[model samples]
Target chain A: MKATVHVTLKPGVLDPQGQTIQRASEAIGFARIADVRQGKFFEVELSDDGDLEAARAELERFARDVLANPVIEDYRVEFLSDLPAASEQE
Target chain B: MKATVHVTLKPGVLDPQGQTIQRASEAIGFARIADVRQGKFFEVELSDDGDLEAARAELERFARDVLANPVIEDYRVEFLSDLPAASEQE
Candidate 1:
C-alpha cells in the first residue's frame, strides 16, 4: 500500500518560504492570489504484507516522531489506492 | 477558492532529502516502509471572483514557472471546494 503525508505549519507560525512564494506570485502579476503557504509532502511505500492497522499506527508514529515538528507543524496521512507502485520493481 | 499544488521529483531523479527520510525511518524501526519520497506542497488561495478556467490555467503556469523545476520535477494541481479560506478574512 501507499500513503501520502502533508506537514504544514500551524496558522500562527511564521513561514518565510511561504511569504517568498506569495511575493513572487505578486511580482509576476498574479493579483488574484491572496496567500501561498508551503509545506512538506511525502509519499511512502509499504510492503504488501505489512499489517494494515499496525502500519497505520507505525506510520503515524513515524510522522510525529520524525516527519513532523509537532511544535510548529501539523500533519495528515492519506492512504492511496492499493495499486502496486511503479517503483516497486526497481 | 483554495487549491493545492504538489511538486515532486520525476522518477530517476536523485532525491537526497528523500533518501535521508528513508534512512531515518529505517533507523527508527519503521520496517514497513519500503521507500519514501519527499516533495513540496503548497496551498494557494484565489480571490472569490477569480475566473475558474483562467485561474486553473494561471495556476498551472504558476506551478510550472514558479513552483516546480520542469527539468527534474513534476507538479500536479488540485482545486478544493468553494469554501472561503480562513485567511481570507485576516
Candidate 2:
C-alpha cells in the first residue's frame, strides 16, 4: 500500500507563504487569481495489506506525531497503489 | 475556474528537501519509507467562465514563468470550481 499525506494550514490561520504566492501571481498578470494556499504533498509507499482503514489510521497518527503541527495544520491521508494521479480532485 | 498547479522536482533532479524529510521519516521509525519526494500544491481561485481548457493553458504558462523553475521542476494543472478536495487522486 502507498499513502499520500497532504499537510496544509487550517482555515482562518495566517499563511504568509500563501499571501506571498498570491502577490506573485498578481505580479505575473494572473490578476484574476484572488487567493492562493500552498500545501505539502508526501508520497509514501508502505507494505501492502489491502486494508485501507488501517493504513489511513496509521498515516493519520504519523501526521499528528511527526508530519504536521496540529495546532495550526491539518492533514489528509489517501491510499494509493502506486504513484498518485496528476489531478486535483473536485 | 480555480486552478491547481503542483510543482515537483523533475525526475533525476536532486531534491534536498525531500532528502531531509526522508531522513526524518527514518528517524521517526517509518523505516519502510525508502524514499520521499516533497512537492508544492498551489490552490488558486480564478474567475470562472466554465472553460477548463483555457484555464489549464493559462496555468501552465504561470508555472513556466513564475510558479516554478521549468528546468528542474515539473508541474501539472487541474481545474476546479471550488476548493480542492482532501484526498489525492490515484
Candidate 3:
C-alpha cells in the first residue's frame, strides 16, 4: 500500500521559500499570482498485509511524529489511490 | 482563488533526501515502511476575477515554467477547493 503526507506551514507562519517562488513567478511574467505557500510532500510505500486500518493508524503516527513539526506545521495523510490524477482537471 | 502545485522527482532520479527520511523512519521504529519519496508542495493564491479557466491555464504555465524542473521532476496543479480535506480518509 502507498500513502502520501502533506506538511504545510501554519497559516500565520512565514514562508521564505514560498516568497522566493512568488518572486520568481512574477519575474517570469506571471503577474497575476498574488501569493505562494510552500510545503513538503512524502510518499510512502508500505508492506501491505490487507490491514488498512492498521496501516492508516501507523501512517498517522508517522506523519504526526516524524514528518511534521506540530508547532509550526499542519499535516494530513491519505492513501495515494484516493487522490485523483493530475490530468483530471476541473 | 487558490491552487496547489505538487512537485515530485521522476521515478529514476536519485533521491538522497528520501533515503535520509527512510533511514530516519527506520531509526524511529517504523519497521513496516518499505520506501519513502519526498517532494515539494506549493499553495498559490490568485486574485479572483471570476475566470476559472483562465486561472487554470495560468497556473499550468506557472507550474511548468517556474515551480518545477521538468527534466528531473514532475508536477501537478489543482484547485485547492477540489481537494478533499485530509480528514476524509478511507
TM-score of each: 0.86, 0.77, 0.84
Clashing pairs in 1: none
- Residue pairs with colliding backbones in model 3 are none
Q: Please list the residue runs of candidate 1 whose C-alpha ends up more than 4 Å from where it truly belongs after superposition.
A: A82-90, B82-90
Candidate 3: where is the Cα deviation over 4 Å? A81-90, B81-90
Winner by TM-score between candidate 3 and candidate 1: 1
- Measured against the native two-chain assembly using Cα atoms, what DockQ does each of the candidate structures obtain, in the order listed? 0.67, 0.51, 0.65
- Model 2 chain A scores worst on lDDT over the 10 consecutive residues at A81-90
DockQ of 2: 0.51
Alpha-carbon RMSD, candidate 2: 7.2
lDDT of 3 by residue, A24-73 (tens): 78887887799999999999998776666666678889999989999999
Off by more than 4 A, model 2: A47-56, A82-90, B49-53, B82-90
> Model 2: what TM-score for its first chain?
0.76
lDDT per residue, candidate 2, B1-90, as tens digits?
567778888889987877887788778776455566777878777765655555556677776777788898888877665323323221
Fraction of the reference Cα-Cα interface contacts (below 8 Å) that each candidate reproduces: 0.86, 0.65, 0.87
The residue-by-residue lDDT of candidate 1 on B47-78, one tens digit each, is 76745776777788889999999999999998
